[model samples]
Target: MENYKIPDNLAVSEEGFLFLPATGESFTLNEIGKIVIGLLKNGSSIEEIIERLTEEFDVDEHTAEKDVNDFLTQLKNFRLVEEI
Candidate 1:
């Protein structure tokens, strides 16, 4: 699993609203998305995120892994996260 990073110019609210200062773009995240982003901001690896998701949410390991992968893809597509 790779480590991901949230850009320095991006601001994320407690309610999962994301704003990119450079692009003047804003996005709202779902609950799971918010958790994933927070974990990424804390420098958690994908594996760690999966573990946390499984532990914190009512999800199994395989399901959590799949969901996290899908979310990561979305983050990449949105230019919100980078592999580092």
Candidate 2:
């Protein structure tokens, strides 16, 4: 699976707040979204992300995969991340 990366123009806060300097846009992420973003930025693969989520959140593999894919889709839609 391809890895994802956050743009340098996107700024993230410890409290799950996101900002895009160039666009003057800001977003707030839920706990899971924040966790996913951190993992993505740290160079985690999609499978690795799903595994980590399952380990941390008491979620099953299928659900973890769905959620991770959905979140990544949303981030892509928002231009927050680019696939590599």
Candidate 3:
């Protein structure tokens, strides 16, 4: 499994608020998003993320995988995270 990283220009707050200094654009995320970002920042692998989500949220592995993939795709689309 590979890890993902949030770029330095992307600032994240305790309340799941994300800000891009270069573009002056900001976005807010839900609790789950915050957890995912935190885990990514901590160098957690993709599989680890799915496992954590399943355990914490009581979701099945298949559903967790789908949601996590969707969330990661959104982050990538917004240029918020990079494959590392």
lDDT of 2 at 61: 98
Identify the leading candidate in terms of TM-score: 2
What TM-score do all the candidates reach, one by one?
Answer: 0.93, 0.94, 0.93
Each model's lDDT comes to 0.90, 0.89, 0.90
Candidate 1 local lDDT, 1-84, one digit each (tens): 677899988899999999988889899999989989998899888899999999998999999998888888888898998779
User: Per-residue alpha-carbon lDDT of model 2 for 1-84, expressed as tens digits?
Assistant: 678898977899999999999889899999999999998878888899999999998889998998888888889998999878
Model 2: how far residue 23 lies from native, Å: 0.7
Whole-model lDDT for model 3 versus the true structure? 0.90
For every candidate, C-alpha RMSD to the true structure in Å: 0.9, 0.9, 1.1
**Regions of model 1 farther than 4 Å from truth:** none
User: Which of candidates 1 and 3 reaches a greater lDDT?
Assistant: 3
**lDDT score at residue 18, model 1, on the 0-100 scale:** 99
Model 2, CA-based lDDT: 0.89
Worst 10 residues of 2 by lDDT: 1-10
Which ranges in model 2 have alpha carbons more than 4 Å from their true place?
A: none
User: After best superposition, candidate 1 residue 28: deviation in angstroms?
Assistant: 0.4
TM-score of 3: 0.93
